[model samples]
Target: MTNSEWRMTAKRDKVLSVSAPVPPEQSIAWPRGKGRALLPLANNSDETIRLHLRGEDPDSACQFGFSLPGEANKSSGSVTLELSPGQVLSLPVSITPPPPSLLGLAPQTYHFTFTVINLSQKERAWTVMGRLKSKPIIGPGLLGVTGICLIALFVPLYRFIENRENREDAFSATPAAEASEAGALWPLLNRGVEQSAPQTPQLAPPDLESLTYEAMFKEVGAAYNLDWRMLAAMAYQESYLDPMAVGALQEMGLMQIMPATWNVWAPKAGVSDPFDPYSNLQVSATYQVYLREYFSGKGHPGNKWMLAAYNWGPDNALQVIESGADWGDVPLHVRRYVLKIMQTDSHPVLSDPRLQESVGGVRE
Candidate 1:
């Protein structure tokens, strides 16, 4: 009879799927934990038969052996049985039945005698084998597969729940000190000043300056916390303190605020008319305050660093700060600005009476 004609049966419930051709030698996989199957061997005649089982993965690695029923000694009705990984094989003996031993192992009792062998990496095949004397009682082998399926379904969900609970606890227990410690390596804000008050003494306020211009200064100065003279100086620098001035370079109004910078600061300063001297100065001063805070430092020594930075971007000024050098030690352009202001001017334009009035007066 062909190997396919061989009948195998299990006694207990556990078998998943039985593989007929266990690699190397014939054997079957009874998934671990549950299941058993029986292979029938001899029906009538009893002759010694050979069976072998071997592992299919690695070479000369895993193997097992079994003997069939009624093949004791004289009859020689025994088969060499081997076992491996994928399948199990059962072969019948072709000799006469032997007389029962005094030990009382009826021929059927030795129907299956198998041993498991471990395979090495060098081995490529393995098998499980047994000798069948008479019809072998079989057991179920599919239940082992069911247990594996249940494990796969539950493991991920269990880990997910565990991780969520851990994160919640960590968030609740973190203290302010620990939070600060964690953030110490990464600061919330960089420390530095933006601008410094001019070094040379400011020009004396024009005696009996108009109340309208004074009121305008108060409103603009309050919005930006700026020294009014700085705004006045920048206006003089840009438009010669001319409120109605518009530049050839898209600069407009007193202080010559750029449209882009004006848009960014105007809403916050409550200034609607960008060209209005008071409104423009209010926003411009506030914007200068922003730049001052951005560049100034609590430990930075002088206001000159802020001025130098405004004149020559923060990066260049930072080099001076790091070197602990005075503005005069730096570039001439930057030093010339403060120095020129310090030198008193006797020219008619410097003494003009109508300058501040014209720039500071804003309608509405």
Candidate 2:
């Protein structure tokens, strides 16, 4: 899966009145889902400014060109311009139809973000969105997308409702305990000081040891409210504490993080150096929290589900569950992987004794 639309964020708050495609399709996308139009970029501020402009397509469905002063259409490289007050420049945007593999039955939106920076280095990002709708019974492509959608959407709901009934029955025995357990569903979201904010000032890499993958893991786990020992076990399993480890799937560094995973979480953790021990740990920890939260919402909480989801892709893990598989029915490798990590959860650690109780139990 490519970067989701939610990952695209603006760099600043200043406003720009960027016009949409010439004839905007407010109802549906263009006929063949291909559109070419000039988007207006107007500088409404009072100051005359030198600006640098570039565009990004997380959707990978669009091509961009800039019309500079002496250059009519410049593709590929960013362009520089000096715009006085009330000056307007046009950006040519072309959205090509997405390939069949990129489509999904629940509908997906595509984003093309334009970023502009002034001489003072004040940057801002503006984005345009195109949506793809579901067409069932069209062919195998649509049918396959529908099948994936059912697994992604319906199965999760079924698990959630089923878990709710279980929770109600368990809580029936004790009123006080019920209220307390109910809040576990959103521990970080309900109240977390620095964790909830997506934009974090870059936390400096720890200096204990250049080879200190353990220190990096503990630091990240503490910041994210995870069990440091458990996280360390995951790293030990993935890379054997080797900072330069490379996985068979092209995943890199201490955590063996996939390139796609790094692309999604790097910005959230406010780091760019993929191979740096601390940077790698930050991405892994952040994604772990996301995965845990996602599984919790799907009615599967605790380390077993979280670790299983981490080992196998969450979709595959859920598919196994939706197929009515028990722990014995999980793929042998995944079961062994999760069991090893859980076994290591009780290992002693020196970093923070306070996180001792954070090692989670497997849901029944």
In candidate 2, which residue pairs get closer than 3 Å at backbone N, Cα or C atoms, i.e. clash? none
Off by over 4 Å in 1: 1-211, 222-224, 298-302, 311-330, 340-350, 355-364
lDDT of candidates 1 onward, in order: 0.40, 0.57
Query: Total clashing residue pairs per candidate?
Result: 77, 0
* Model 1 lDDT-worst window of ten: 26-35
Q: Which candidate number has the best lDDT?
A: 2
Q: Please, what are the lDDT tens digits per residue for candidate 1 over residues 85-116? A: 33333322121122222222222322232222
Cα lDDT tens digits, model 2, 34-147, are 333334556667767677766666755655566554545666636777777777655544444453334334433455556566654356445543333322224454465555
